[model samples]
Target: MPVTARHLIIQGRVQGVFYRNWAVALARDLSLSGWVRNRRDASVEMWVEGAAEAIEQFIAQAHEGPPAARVLRVIAQPVETEGFVGFEKRPTA
Candidate 1:
């Protein structure tokens, strides 16, 4: 499987709703490496690295985050690398 990375900006009702924790669990379930953090702009930012298919799955699931979250938009961009060992929840940015 080809490995790839993506930087995703998930906006709208993504903070304080267990979004970060949900992301970590989802990434781990997919056997991916990356980090998810909250932005000052009230959006969630994630950098994920793993099999191309897994990354795509992660993005798709992120669009429908935890029940409390109301995901408005998901902006995903190709990234070179995130240098992560395992999925983690990062400090708010």
Candidate 2:
């Protein structure tokens, strides 16, 4: 299957809610490769790449993050894929 890559920005009540950890867990489970991190604007950002179906599932789930996350919106943009071995949690940017 071809890889579908995306850059996503999640907004609203995403911080302090273990959003990054949630993302990593799900992405890995979906056999995805990417990195998720927190932004200074109190939002969260991530770049994911994998099977098209996996990407779709990842984005769909991102709209409703961890139990504590109140994801108001998820902005997904198609982007060129990068070299990522596995899902990771990056320091806040």
Worst 10 residues of 2 by lDDT: 79-88
Model 1 agreement with the true structure over 1-33: per-residue lDDT tens digits: 778999999999999999999999999999999
lDDT of 1 at 2: 74
Cα lDDT for residue 11, candidate 2: 99
Q: What TM-score, over all chains together, does every model reach?
A: 0.96, 0.97
- RMSD, each candidate, Å? 0.8, 0.6
Prediction 2 TM-score vs. true: 0.97
Best by lDDT: 2
User: In model 1, where is the ten-residue run with the lowest total lDDT?
Assistant: 81-90
Q: Model 1: residues >4 Å from true position, as ranges?
A: none
Residue-pair clash count for candidate 1: 0
Tens digit of per-residue lDDT, candidate 2, span 1-93: 787799999999999999999999999999999999999999999999999899999999999999999999999999998878999999989
Q: Which of the numbered candidates is closest to the native, going by highest TM-score?
A: 2
